[model samples]
Target chain A: MERVLDMTIQEVRELLRKKEISSVELTGFYLERIKKYDGSLLTYLRVTEEEALEMARDADRRIGQGEDGPLLGIPLGIKDIFCTKGIETTCASRILEGFVPPYDATVIKKLKDRSFVHLGRLNMDEFAMGSSTENSAFQTTKNPWDLSRIPGGSSGGSASAVAAGLCAAALGTDTGGSIRQPASLCGAVGMKPTYGRVSRYGLIAFASSLDQVGPLTRSVSDCAVVMNAIAGYDPMDSTSIPQPVPDYTELLGRDIKGMKIGIPREYFIEGMDEDVKRAVRESLAVFEHQGASLVDISLPHTEYAVATYYVICTAEASSNLARYDGVKYGLRIDGKDIIDMYKKTRSKGFGKEVKRRIILGTYVLSSGYYDAYYRKAGKVRTLMRRDFDEAFKACDIIVTAVSPTTAFKTGEKIDDPLTMYLSDIFTIPMNLAGLPAMSVPCGFDGSGLPIGLQIIGRPLDEGRIMQAGYVIERERAVKKIPDTLR
Target chain B: MKITKDVVEYVAHLGRLELEHDEVELYTTQLDRILDYVDALNKLDTEGIEPTSHAVPLDSVMREDEVRDSIGVDSSIRNAPERKETFFKVPPIIEVEE
Candidate 1:
C-alpha cells in the first residue's frame, strides 16, 4: 500500500490493467487510508465508500471484458461543488446540505464515462467564496504539512487530500485561484484550463464567467491524464469552447528546448514571501538548463485583478447563488411570506463569508453601483486580458508564484476579508485573462512548506502549459508525499 | 463610508436577505473597506474600451431547436422544500392589498 501510494497514477493504471491488483482492492486501499488519515486531515466532506466500491466492482467486471482507458478503475476525490446524481453536493454550504442532484455535472459524467471511482465529495469554501477552507459549513481542512495551518482553498480539501494520498488525484474548481492556490500551498499539481476550455454544465455556479472545473493531481502527468478525460465541449454548456480536445499526455517526457518562459514583473511584487521569490528566482536556472529561455515581461493591469475579480465574481455570485432561496432545494426556514422565507432561509443558511460576498455582490450589481463597479470591472478585465495577449505574443509560457506565501495558519486571514482576498493575488490575474495555468511544486520554504510557481499558457494552450509544468515537476522533484502520510 | 448600515440593509433587502442588526453594521464596515479598496479601478482609463464580460469572444452556435430529454418534473422538484405534486409549493408570494 505504501509503494502504491508513492507510485504515480500511470503505474496504478498498469497494475490495474495487468490484473495484478483488482479495482476493488485499490479502492479499498484508498478507503482504508482515508479512514486512517482523514480524521486528522478532515479533507473529505463525505466518503462515498459504498459508491466507490460499486464503481470499482464495475471496473473490475469491465476489465474482465478487456476494457481499458487512461483513468480506468482509478479512485479519485471530488470537490463537493460538482453536482453528482443521487449524491448530495453541498458546495460546502449549509443551504444546500441535503440537495441531491438528479444528474451528474458534465465533467462528472465525463469522468464516470471513463470508469473512475469516486472516493467521495471533498470539502471546499462555502460557495467557493473564501480563500481558506475554514469557510466550510462542515469542517475546516487542515494542511497536511502542519495541522495548525490551513490547506489553501476553496479547493483546499481536494489539494490536501491529494497531497496526503487520501485520493490518487482529485477534481477541484478554480474560479479565482481555488485550484492553483490550494494546489500550490499543498505541493500538489493543479491545472486550470482556459475559461471556456472545460464544460461547466452542472458545476454549481459561483462566478459563471470565472468559474472553471479543474483537476488537482498527485503528479503533473496525472493532472494531464485527468485533463484528457474531462476537457471537451458539451452542448449543455454554451460557454464551453467547441474545440478538439488534445491528448495532454503526449508531451509527458518531451523536451521543451528553446521554449520562452515569460516572467511577469507584476506578479513578483513587494509583500511576496521572500522564500517564494527566491524559489522562483532560483528556478530561472533550472528552466535555462532545461533548454528554455526566461523572458522578462510586464502585465500592467495586474494590480487591478483582485479588485476587478471581487466585483465581477461577487456580482455573478449574487446572481448565481440567488437560486438557493429555500424553494426548490436544500435547507429551508419557513416565514410568513415567500420573500420573508427567502430572507429567513438565506440569512440562516449561508455562512458569514458567503453572506458577505452575497451582500457585496448585491451591492455592486444593484441599480446605482452597476456601472461603476460591475461594468468598470468588466472593462478592466478586458485590459487584463489584453496585457496577457500582448505578453503571450513574445512568450509561449509564463511563470509566477502560485501564492504570495506558503499555507497560512488556520484563522490567520479568516477574520480579515481583505487580507484573505489578497491570498489569491498572484493567481487571480490569470483567471481574469482566461488562460491555462498550472501550479507545480517548485521548492520548500525554510519551514519545509512547499512553494509553487504557476506555468501559464495562452488561451486554449493547456497542452503547452502542461508540457512546461511537466518539465518543472521533473526538474524540481520535491518531496510530494506529505509528512503526515509518512 | 461608501457603505453605511442603512445601505447594507437596503442591499440585503434587495437580495431578499434578512440581516441582523450586527450583520448590517459589520457588513457596512467591511463592504466600505472593500469598496474603498476597489475604488482604485477608477484610476484606469477605460474610456473607449468595451466591457468584455467573457474573455473569449463567443459566436452563437446555430443548432437545430429540438425537444430533448429534460430532468423531468419528478426529478426537478424532488429536492423542493415543499412540493405539491409536480409543482414547488411556496409561501404566499402575491400579497393581497386591503
Candidate 2:
C-alpha cells in the first residue's frame, strides 16, 4: 500500500479502476484514520461509519457493473451547514443540537445518487458566523498543521479534514470568506462558485444573498469534478441559475499563453504581511513566466469592502436568523407570555457572536434607521460591484493573497472580535461582487505554516477561474506537509 | 458613533435576545468600537447612487400558480416546541382583565 492517505482524488479513482483498491477498503482506510487521528484534530462532529461502508459496498458493485462516475466511491467530509436527511445538521450550534433534518441539500443528494461515500459531518462556526472554528459550540477544531494553532473557519473542519488526509475531499459553505480563508490557512484548495451556480436548497442561511456552497479538496481538478456533480438548477432553490452546466474538466490542462491576469494594486498595501506578499509575488512570477500577462488594476472601493460587507451581511443575517424563534423549531423555553418565550429561548440558544450580529443587524434594519444605515450600505455595495466590473473589463482574472498572514496561534485574537474579523479582509470583496474565487497553496511562512494565493473570476465564469487555478497549483510545486502531522 | 449601554439593550430587545447586566456593558463597548470602524462609510460620496440589493441583474422569476402537494404541515411542525392538534400553539396576545 502506497499510503492511500497521500493520494489525490484522481489517483484514488485510478487505483479503483485497476482493482488495486476496493471502495470498501478505501472507506475503511479513511474511517480508521478518522478514528485514530480525529481526536486531536476534532475535524468531525458525526461519523456515519455504517452508512459510509454500505455506500462504499454499493460503489464497488456499481464499478463491477461497469458504471463508475467521477466521484464513485470517493469519501467526502460534509460541512454540517448542509442538511442531510435523517442526519444531524447542527451548523455547530446548541439550538439544533439534536435536530435531524428530514431532507437533504441538493449537493448532498447529487453526491449520494452518484454513489459517493459519506465520511461524516464536519464542524463549523455556529451558523457559519466566525472565521475560526473556535466559535463552534460543540468543540474547536485545531489546524492539522499545528495543534497549538487555529484552523481558519467557519469551514475550518472541512479544510483541516482534507489537509490532514482524513477524507479525500470535503464540501463547504462560504458566505464571505468561510471556505477560502480556512482553505488558505490549512493548505487546501477551496472554491466558491459564482453566486447561483450551486443550488442553496437545504443550506441554512447565514446571509441569504451572500451564502454559497462549494468544495474544499486537495487539488483543483478534484474541485472541478465535485462542482460538475453539484452545479445544476434545482426547482427547489429559486435563486439557482437556469443556465446550462459546463464540463469543468474539459478546460483542464489548457494553455495560458497570452492570457491577461490582473493584480489589484490596492490588495498589496502597507499592512499585508511581508512573507505573504513575497509568496504571492513569486506565484505571480510563475504565471508571467508561463506566458501570461500581469496588469496592474485598481479597485478603488477595495478599502471599503470589509465595512460594506459587515453592514450588509449583518443586516441580512439579522433578518434571516430571526426564523429561529421558539415558535417554529429548535430550542424553546417556557415563559409567562409569547414575547418572554421568544426572548428566553433566543438568549439561551444563541452564542455571544450570533447575538451581537443579530442586534447590529436589527439596529441597521430598523424602521427609523433603515434609510441611513441599511440603505446607505446598499448604495455603497453598488459602487463596490462597479469597481469589479471595471477591473474585469481590463483583465480576464484577478489574483491576490487569500489572507494577510498564515495560521496564527489558537488564542491570539479570540477575545478581540474585530481582530478576528480582519482575517478575511482580502476575501470579503469577492462575495460583495458575487464573483467566483478560489484559494491554492502558494508557499509556507518562516515557521512552516502554509500560505495561499487567491484567483478571482467574473460573475458566473468559474470555468476560467478553475482552469487558471489548475495552471498555478501545478506550477507552484508547493506541497507542504505540516510538521505536526508528519 | 458611541454606542451606549442603553442602545445595546434596546437593540437586544429588538433582536429578541435577552442579555445580562454585565454582558450589556461589555457588548456596548465592543459594538461601539466596531460601529466606529465601519462609520467610515459616512464619508463616501454616494449622493445620487441607488441601493443595489442583488449582484446579478434579475427580473421577476415567478412560478406558475399551480396547486401541488404541500411539504406536509405535520412533518414541518414535527419539531415544534408547543403544538395542539396538528397546529403550533403560542401564548394569546391580548389579555382580558376584569
Candidate 3:
C-alpha cells in the first residue's frame, strides 16, 4: 500500500484500470499521509479533506461509468498563488490570509474538469518574491530531503508536497524559476511551459510578463499529463495564445534518436557549484548513450539576463501589486488619511523582500530613471531573446543547470538579498526569452541534496522539451527518494 | 553607487510602503549592494538595441467592453476586518485645512 505513494501518475492510472485500487481509496490514503506527515513537512497551508473526498467520490462514480481522463482521480497540491473558488488563495501573504477567492484560475478549472481531487493549497513566498519558502509570511516549508535545509522556492510547498508523497502532483507558478528551482531542490519533475501557453487569468500577478503556471510531478510523463490539461487558450486571459494544444501523452515514448541537443557554454562556467556541474555532465552522457548528439552553443547575451529580469520584473511587479491597496480587497490598515492608510496597509501587508522589490521597481520606473533602467532593460531583453533564437536554429532543445547550486540551509542567504537573488541565475534567461523550460532531477550532491538539469525549448514547443526530459529521466536512472523523507 | 537614506525614503513613499527608521537604513544598504552587483549591466554595450518586453512576440490583445453581472461579491468581503452595511469602513480622509 505504501508503494502506491511512490508510484507515478501513469502507474496509478493503470492500477485504477485494473481495479486494484479505487479513487476513494487513493484519496483516503493521501489524506491520511497528509495528516500524519504534514506537521513536520509544513508543505500544505490548508488541506481540503471534505472537498477532496467529494471530488474523489465523483471521480470514482465516473470511473464506474467508464468515463476517464488522464488525471481522473489524481490528487493535486495547488500553490496558494492561484485563485481557487471558495478556497483561500493567500500567495502565502497575510494580506490575503483568510480571503477566499470567488473564482477559479483557468488551470484550476481544467483540473477540476478532469476530476483531479483538490488536495489543498500549498504555501509560497509572499507574492512569490523570494527563492526560498522562508519568505512565505505564513510558514516556512522544509525540504523533504532535509528538514533542516530550505526548500528552494517560491513553489517550495508544492515541490515538497510532491516529493514527500503528500500529494500525487502539484501546480506551481514560475516568475523567474519559482517552479523549476524548487523542483530541482526537492528532486521532482517541474516544467514551466512557454509564456502564454497557459492562461494567467486566475494566477495572482507577480511580475506579469515573466509569471507562468506549471506542474510539479514525480516524473516527466506525469508533467506531460498535467500540461495537456492546462495548456490552451482561455477567454479570460487575454495574453493566452490561441493555439491548439497537442496531446502531450502521444509523444511519451517517442524516439529521441538523432535529436540535436544544445549545451550552452555559458551555463557551465564559473560560480556554478561543482556538484551541479558533475551531475549535469553525467546526465549529458546519458543523452549521448541514447544516440542524441550535443552541440555546443553560445548565448552571448546570457550575461545580461539577471539584470534585465530584475529591472523589467520589478517594474511590472510594482504596477501589478498596486491593486492590493487596503480599499477594494485584501488587508487594510486603518490610518488618519487615505495616504497614511495606503502606506500602513502596504507596509504591514508586504514582507521585507516584497517591499524591497517594490521600491526597486518604483525607482527604475520613475520619470528620471525610466529610460536609463526600465527602458534599457527592455532593450537588453530583446538581445537576450535573439541569443536564444540563434541558438535554437542549431539545436532542437537547449540544456543547462536550473540553479547555480542546490538548496541552501534556511537563513543561509536570507539577510543577503543579492546572494538569494543569485540562486536563480540560470533560470531568468529562459523567462526573458519566453521559452518553455523544464527541470528534471538528474543527480544528488555529496550531501544527498537533489540537483536538476534544465531543458529549454523553442517558443510553443513544449512537446520537444518534455520529450527530451522524459528521455533523459529514464536513461539517467537517478531516481531515488530522499532518506529524510522516507 | 551608495544609496542614501533619503533615496530609500523617497522610493518607499513612491512604492506606497511605510518604512521605519531602522528599516530605511537597512534597505538603503541592501539596495545599494544589489544595485552595485547588477550594475554589471551598464558595462554591456546595448547602444542601438530595441528593448524587449514580452518574451514571445505578441500584439495588443484588446477585447470589446461589455457590461456583465458581477459575481464573488460575498467572498470578496468575507475577510474584511471591519465592514458596516456591507461596505468596508475606514478612517475619514477629508482634508481639514480646506
Q: Note the DockQ of each predicted structure.
A: 0.87, 0.77, 0.65
| Candidate 3 residue spans exceeding 4 A from truth | B62-69, B72-90, B96-98
lDDT score of residue A224 within candidate 2: 89
Give i-RMS (Å) per prediction: 0.9, 1.2, 1.9
Backbone atom clashes (below 3 Å) for every candidate: 0, 1, 3
Candidate 1: DockQ? Answer: 0.87
The per-prediction CA RMSD against the true structure, in angstroms, equals 1.1, 1.5, 1.8
Top model number, lDDT = 1
lDDT of 1 by residue, B1-98 (tens): 76778888998998888988888888888889999999999999999999989877887877898898888889999999899978989988787899
In angstroms, give how far residue A162 of model 3 lies from its true place: 0.7
Which of 1 and 2 is the better model by DockQ? 1
Which model scores highest in DockQ?
A: 1
lDDT of 1 by residue, A296-339 (tens): 99999888999999999999998998998998899999998888
True contacts kept of 2: 0.81
What tens digits encode model 2's per-residue C-alpha lDDT throughout B42-81? 9899999988887766656788899998668777787777
Better of 2 and 3 by TM-score: 2
DockQ of 2: 0.77
Ranking by lDDT: 1, 2, 3
